[model samples]
Structure formats: C-alpha cells, structure tokens
Target: MTQQNKIRICVAGATGWAASALCKAIIKTPDIELVAAISRSNAGKNLSEVLSLDTEKNIPIFATVEEALQVPSDVFFEYTSPVIAKHHILSALRAQRQVIVGTSGLTDEDYASIEAAAHDSGRGVLAVGNFAISVVLLNRFAEMAARYMPHWEIIDYASDKKVDSPSGSTLELVSRLAKVGQPITTIPIQDTKGYPETRGAAINHTQVHSVRLPGYIVSLEAIFGMESEKLILRHEAGSSAEPYVNGALLAIRKVQLVKGFRRGLDSVMD
Candidate 1:
C-alpha cells in the first residue's frame, strides 16, 4: 500500500481480545485506517476506553454487521469466534469488501465458498492460522524438509480446557505437508496404556501430538527423523501482539493485489 492511499479497514467483533489488539495495530499503522469497528456488547463505548487508544476521535460502535456495512470500508478484519466467523466473513464479502480473516473455525467447505466469492468479486481473502512471521518461516522450513526427509511430524501446544483438540496451527502445517507426500509411518497414541488420549490428535497421514498446558501463548515443533539424524523447527509466541500486527497490515495492504482467496499466511506475503 502507498502512503497516500491509506487502506481503510473495519474490525468486526471489535471488543474481543484479538480484535482489540487488531484495532490497536490499525491505529498505529500509517498506511492503514480504522474506518469502522463493531461490537454488540460494547456499542456506544470508546475504543480508547476498551483498548486505551490515545487519539481523541469520536469512534462510533455498531451492534451488528448489518449496521456496520451501511458504511463502506476497503477491507474488513474478521476476528470473532469460529461460530460467527463464516457468516461474518461472507457478510463482508457480500458487501463487496476484501477480507482478512483471523478467526479459526473455517472448514474446507467454508473456504471453498470464500474462494468463489473472492474470484467473483475480483477481491482478495486472506486466512491465517497464525500470523507471526517466524511461524511462517517455520512452515517454510517444514516444506523444505518435506523435499528431502519426507518423514516429519508436527506437534502443537495450547492451554488445557481449550476445547479444540488439534490446533489450527498444527492442522495448517500438516495440510502444507500434504502438498508434499504421505509420511512414512503413523503413530497412534491410543495404542499406549498411560493417559489414553494424552498424546494428542493425528493429521495428514502424520502424527501430531497436542499439548495443552496453562502457560503458553502458542508453540509448535516439527520433527524429522531418519538415519540416526533429526531435524527440528520451532516457534513460540510471546504475549506481545506486535509481531502479528505487521502481517495483518500486510494482508490489508496486499488484499486487493490478489484475484481470489488465499488459504495460508504465506500466500499473500512478499
């Protein structure tokens, strides 16, 4: 995006944890503008109060997408829960706006629909499991290992009581690995006696062990083993939200540059 042509954006579910962080990121980016923000529970409240924004502009809130889409925006940041993401993203696309979807519940069917919409509208749809640049590089590393090792497994970690068994990051990584080939073997933890399902879920013809503990933001390690040698690639996210901000900005700037939907964080990346 050029300096003069600021990318106008609206962040849906504006009061949530990730959406609030996204709004703050948009606030500081010179190349982007928060044209609109919507949150039903926080309607009529100030972004400054909820997110501690220093700027003194009267930012109005809307109760729903129907209200928010009355005003147009260049791009829409869809950051609600999985239950609402599919409908919210489709709403933005129907409004003829580009999208940067950060929410996780999108299945393959949902993606196919978004793909059709993006192609028909001649806009871009960018979906990312995790936006950290180091995570992107870790995926690249896994892709590279697939070329030679062809024997890597993915393991992703999250907090306990998180309902999702396999993480979106792990699913995304294994999906990429699927583009390469089937792994050599599959290990089923259910066959073991201790902890039963404690070893985690499996995906893409490979073993993906899920770890849920209290103190982690998000972390993953890809393990490749063969001939008495092993390759490991790992990335850990700190609580600071700044790293993800740049990628979000990148998606907003680069959204209109593509013709259709993009599945991975690396697709629209330069």
Candidate 2:
C-alpha cells in the first residue's frame, strides 16, 4: 500500500476497555486509518467523544458493524463482548474482511463456523486470550516445559468482575500446550473441600483452575509438580491494557497478508 492509501481499519466494541486503549495507541501509528468504530452505547457519537479522546483524534463511531461496513476497510478488530464477538467475526469474514479478535468465551461451535468462513473467504482471522508479549512468551515456555514434564495443569486468574471461568486464556494455553502434551486426565485430586467442582473445569484433558478476585488484571500459571520441586511458570498482566494494543495492531496490519484462520497472538511475537 502507498502512503496515500494506508490500510482502512474498523474497530468493533469501540468503547470497551481494551478497544479504547487500542484506539489511543492507533492514534500514534500512521500505517492505519481508523475508518470505523462500533459501540452500541456510543453510536452516532464521534469516536473521540465515545472514547473520551481529544478533539485532535477525529474518528467516527457507529452503532453496528454492518453500518461501519458501509465504508471500506481492509481489516476489522473485533473486541466486542465474547457472547457477540464470534458473530462480529463471522460477519466481517462474510464481508470478506480480515479480523483480529481479542474477545474470549467463544464456544467450540463458533470456532468451527469461523474456521469454515475463513477458508471460504480466504481472509485471515486471529484470536488470542491475553495479547501481552509476556503472555505469549509464557505460552511458549509452557509448551516447551510440557515436552519435558508431560504432566501438568493450568490456572487462570482474573478480577472478581471477570465472569468467565477456565478463561479463554486457559483454553489457549491448554490447546497450545497440547502441541507438546496437555496431560490426558484431570490433575490429581488430593484435597477436596467436599466439592470437587471447585477445582474448575477441564479442557483438552487438562485441569484448568479459574480464580476470580479483585487484585489483578489477568494472569495464568502452568504448574508442573514432579518428585520434589514444583515448577510454576506464570504470566501476569499488569494494570493496563496497553500491552494488548501492539499485538492486536500487529495482527490487524498483517491480516491482509494472511489467509484462513490463525490462532494465538504468538504468531506475531518473537
């Protein structure tokens, strides 16, 4: 693309915590044009007003993704709530646009449909749980450790306000860990407080413990306990969403260069 014809980008869930942060970061990059912003609550408002950005940051906000599509865009960043994120992704795909999704809680059925749509549209779709660079590294390390340990589990942490348990992060972690080995059975049960369900859910045959509290942004740990010393590998998201911005932006800018559905933020990370 020439300097005059930079990539046109649309952001779904414009007013969200992450989307707002991404928009602020997008302002700094000249490689992309913020053509559309979607937020049901802030519909019809200027993007700046919706995100509480300065007047210098001029961008339009729309109520629906379809409305944003009225304009031309090369990529769409889908940050809508998890319940609706897949729908937004599918819609964007049907429009033959690449999508970078940060939302979680997608059902397996939605993934199947998304994979098919990506194949049919010949466009790229990238999704990840936590987009921070460190989280990507954590996943990478976990994958390596799995090759050696072969027996371990996952623990996902979030603020009490966070609703999803066994978060998308855990799913991503477990799925990627499966590339080496996601233990094919629940983590051994030693102490149960009269309720085995408190141990959280199981995915890919690995135990995933979800902890919700008011102390953190988001975090995940890969625990491998063998003979004596236990290995605890973790990635903690600090108090800001800035870390996710770069990863999402990189995926968005590269979406046009890829085809089919790609999973994980690590694809763009070292």
Best by lDDT: 2
Candidate 2's C-alpha runs over 4 A off are 1-3, 52-58, 184-194
The estimated TM-scores of all candidates read 0.89, 0.91
Q: How accurate is candidate 1 locally (lDDT)?
A: 0.78
RMSD of each: 2.7, 2.4
Per-residue lDDT tens digits for candidate 2, residues 1-270, read 465677888999878888889887776677877878898887887897667664465677888778888878888888877777877888888898888878878766777899899999888888787778888888888887777776787888889998777677787888787677557343355455577887667676787888888896788889986666678998888888888888877777776777887778877554
Question: How far off is residue 1 in model 1, in Å?
Answer: 11
Instruction: Tell me how far the alpha carbon of residue 244 in candidate 1 is from the true structure, in angstroms, after superposition.
Output: 0.9
Compare the candidates by TM-score and give the number of the best one: 2
| Per-residue accuracy of model 1 over 181-263 as CA lDDT, tens digit each | 88775444566777755555556577788788999767899999888899999988887777787777777788777668876
Q: What are the lDDT figures for the candidates, one per model?
A: 0.78, 0.80
